[model samples]
Target: MGKATGFLEYTRINPKKRSPEERIRDWNEIRLPRDPEVVKTQGARCMNCGIPFCHSGVLLNGMASGCPLHNLIPEWNGLIYKGQWEEAYKRLTRTSPFPEFTSRVCPAPCEGACTEGHILESVTINSLEYEIIEKAFAEGWVVPRKGKATGRKIAIVGSGPAGLSAAYYLNTVGHEVTVYERSDRVGGLMMYGIPNMKLEKRIVERRFVLLKESGINFILNTEVGNDIPAQELVDQYDAVVLCAGATKARGLDVEGSQLKGVHYAVDFLGVNTKSLLDSNLQDGKFISAEGKNVIIIGGGDTGTDCVATSIRHGCKSVYQFEIMPEPPAQRIEESNPWPEWPKKLKVDYGQEEAISLSGKDPRNYLISTKKMAGNEKGEVKEVHTVEIAWVKNASGRMVPQEVPGTEKVWQADLVLLAMGFLGPEDRIADELKLDRDSRSNVKAEYEVFQTNLDKVFTAGDMRRGQSLIVWALQEGKLAAREVDKYLMGKSVIK
Candidate 1:
């Protein structure tokens, strides 16, 4: 709308990243700082469609269609094009509580649903967002907000994206908010589950400092259900919001899964990050992938993260296994049409680094792990796998059926299970006696976010199971709104 022919005039240019060889040597962010002029031109590429699907924030084919936070995409893009960066940052923060976190970690479903992507390439929405927030921070435009005291007290369990979001909004409305983190630091999974190369710890710490300046209280290294009883919090606070993530890592149930060298992906990532932060890996408390041929059992983001981390640790070789078939190189429009998340092959950072070193992608599609073989010391030594085909059963459900004569074995010094999570842990849920859904997640309806218990609520992964951080942020914001309405009988939070 700003340039009229901007969409036609400007081709999309992605942000630059450090080369694989250079980046693999250290634990630092992969993306280079964006050039302001390049970002402005990228912003001009937004057509500002009559119907901006980029911010629809809906679900199609069970995957997120657009920005889950419903970001004001067109408005900010227009602002950036006109050289009004401060205003663009203001428009961004109107809805998003943490653009810094999402700009780094989110898969950017918004771009997938962009109108421009339906024809030409999508506008560089993600890159524009990253620049706007970074500029805001550098210019000191970011500030804490706290409303007049409502005298209401609220407690949030877990200091992850969801919990932190709820705390931010609730504190902004002048409610006394206290966040309880079981870990030694804040930002839950963002603090440790995520590797440093993707999202630096300092970015999270920066936001934590702002939230503290806003007067929201933080209690670290203290778990609610363990250090103090759940009932005590229920009695102490006017309301309690459970943002405890779906942290029960799904186990790889197979022979020799108990081998000493086999470990959960979360444990591997978390321990490595903690050790890195505490002693720069000098403590020797973390698992080392050095001098090991690693096998990752799962082809998700977590698995990709493991591959990257392993490369950083100087792994000899690595391979990722996926039970599903490989996605097509391009979107199959007949099946995966526009507005739905496109199912296509993408060479992520991990695969890029692996390919740079080995001249081949590390992912193995349509492969399933049968079992793990261990050495005399009870340490995993090799992984047994088989290629499979998806076939319809009598129930009309697609299931993995073993292909004939496809068994294979590969040497593996370490095995990482990146199969995702099951649900929230039982400690807090059991103590609170909260009802659960069929999938073992806490029973809390979307938008409502209220549990069966009085004055108690749930949001994020605990309520919806394993999901994107964007969804968690939205859930937290909505849950905060519901809490505000319940407390004041009318709420100002939108």
Candidate 2:
């Protein structure tokens, strides 16, 4: 450790954020630049624990407990404490291919598992990571480093985090990688699923430019199974890596779901981002929430993003519904002890903005929508909801029991279903006849990443259901290793 007693001397400090009122006016990121000295002080708070569980990257009690990339947290923290910014950046990039994205968006499971967090506040690992990478970019330390050509060709389907990470590593190992994206832009989820207020599109664009210069090829507006035959890729490339994310949105099964003005959260967010990038949102090509009372179904990150985006669109009123009960204000020490991800209440940026604008949290817990009421014009007008109680049924399983006489109708001009994804779209699976698990995810073993089809591999949300960007990166790296080995009889990717 750089400072043995640094944990006791310093409390956790996070980066400054733009005020809710000021930031909601535009689509820029909410966080302001953090002071380098302050970040160094925060980095010093890392304790010299005998077993650094923060780097374990394990899932405990159904929640992530540490960095999925197994980042060298303590090493880089010590480097930053000693004012070695370049060394810290190097240590960061050694494991993480895209700290710029993770630093901005990842929920920081590493901090949740920090040794200091058991008794006191955890070190600001996420902010410190962002600072290190940003400094590296400013200092021109991040440049192209291409490996000698291996003369082997690989095709990566999808250009999201998983695809990009696989392309980066496989290219570095001297393989010819071509990433295919159906959209005009690269980043799938990062570009569209997430709002710009959290991760700016320009950040993704910067990485895309660097990746292109480093020798990877990007083919945009090309759908693999539809636009091009899936077998053609298998015939042309030595191996095919499918990082196409789980994008089939789960639909609300209630009545009136097909009404106009009702949409999936991804569609709503994607359209807005595409329009914004095309012309700063001047073309008005997206579903508008302006002056409309909005209802968002679901209570995860997607729902939060919908709330914030609707607010930015100048919505009249917004309401978010979560089927599950609210989490505890603090971790239940008796059940969720140290090193397990604390199941606690967290007010994300979108919730903060909603609170500022509406003078309320805008979230309704233990609520489920019954149906949507439509106006004569076929647009959504009202949402009927019911309170539910989780009670044991005859099967001895907890099931949602609707409370009698608890139905209420709320005004809703636009309803966005932010429920999670089901799995990857069936187009590719059907075209390639790839085996799928019970959950409909591509059937590929972890670490091996090989599908039943010869020379075909799958990773990320396509293999494992919808998950975090960090997990996608991990899968991509692992899959790239397997692909390299399959091509060259063995791999040295790690």
Candidate 3:
């Protein structure tokens, strides 16, 4: 707990961000660092609740209610309040392997679950975590950890958060870990799927350096099911943990979906990041929105990212379409009560930049794309859409009913689909003949993490479908524990 009256005495203060106008000029991280004294005060705002639901790590109404990794938020907050920097770092690293990643990208369900947030402003737990981890690195306190050799080997597919987490723990417990990634770089989505302004590539590279120093090997530009068969990994390593994320992006089904200028949001973000890192966008390898009117389908994080990226590319104009209705500005207490992830409207960095550039938010709510039109060259030129209302069907399930008079056409030179993912790809599962769930995710139970094959384990989006990075990190940790148990009959990972 923090000071007895700290919650009453201090108010929450978040870190500042670089002005959108200034940040859009480059791909650097947008968040500015908070002063040490200010961070301490923010930490002091944590209320010493009788029951801390910030670390409950439960699912509520299909959304994460608290820290999925069960981060010791209150303890770290108290430590930071006392200026015990090293102690806070230690407490944070106890459960969180990648505080840097989560602090930057996670929606921070812990804050929504914060007891103080029910009545007052919540503690800046996410900001405090970022400060602690960065300070830990600065003080040279963070280092690679390896245990006595257990003479076992683990092959992890995908270099995403889950795979990296499992590799960190498995290597720490003296197991030889080899990670396979189809991408040229480490940190699967973190490196590519996410844009650099949100999470700088150097930050991911820093962690990758530490992981390599800790004796984990990475095979780059090699597909597990293609380059080397899925069976080959199981035959070589004592255990195999699949962390390949849910990469099979859901595609549009309407007419003109095959237009040349239409692309997946994943490819748009990934190629932009890759080209930026490779040549600072000097190469024309990425899909450009420069001087073109863009239309983005689906309004999630990916859609938001597409909007920002299009703005940065100097797109003439951009619009994002969402099939779902817009959320309330404030959480509806009747339907979404305290301690559950707030179902409210959030203006993220992308929207902020777009609003700064254009005098209005670029998102369109309750709109569905009817079809697309292309020019003679077969590139996307226009998008047809209609407004719809959510009405109950005969079966009592809500469905979209089109509003007849709301038909509209939008000028669109490039169309990006950000409708999220269906599940993991089919190559590995088909080749290995692995069982799949109803959602087409790899059939691996939580905690156990073991698939039909005894040695074949799975985690992350590949197992749970599209989810937050915090959940992936936790799954990786738990899956590592399961692999350790299988290898040595017992594990000291926890």
The predictions' CA RMSDs to the true structure, in order, are 0.7, 0.9, 0.8
Query: What are the per-residue Cα lDDT tens digits for candidate 1 across 1-494?
Result: 56778999999999999999999999999999878788878988999999999999998989999999999999999999999989999999999999999999999999999999999999888888999999999999999999999999999999999999999999999999999999999999999999999999999999999999999999999998999998899999999999999999999889999999999999999999999999999999999999999999998899999999999999999999999989999899999999899999999999999999999999999998999998899999989999999999999999999998999999999999999999999998888899999988999899999999999999999999999999999999999999999899978877
Q: Kindly give the number of clashing pairs for every candidate.
A: 0, 0, 0
Candidate 3 has an lDDT of 0.93
lDDT of each: 0.95, 0.93, 0.93
Question: How far is 324's C-alpha from truth in model 2 (Å)?
Answer: 0.7
**lDDT of candidate 1?**
0.95
Top lDDT hit: 1
| TM-score, predicted candidate 2 vs. hidden true structure | 0.99
| TM-score computed on alpha carbons, candidate 3 | 0.99
List candidate 1 segments past 4 Å from native.
none
Q: What is the lDDT of residue 331 in candidate 3?
A: 81
Model 1 deviation from the true structure expressed as Cα RMSD, one decimal place: 0.7
What C-alpha lDDT does candidate 2 achieve relative to the native structure?
0.93
Shift in Å, residue 218, candidate 2: 0.6
Candidate 3 structure quality by residue, lDDT tens digits, 433-468? 999999999999899999998699999999999999
TM-score of each: 0.99, 0.99, 0.99
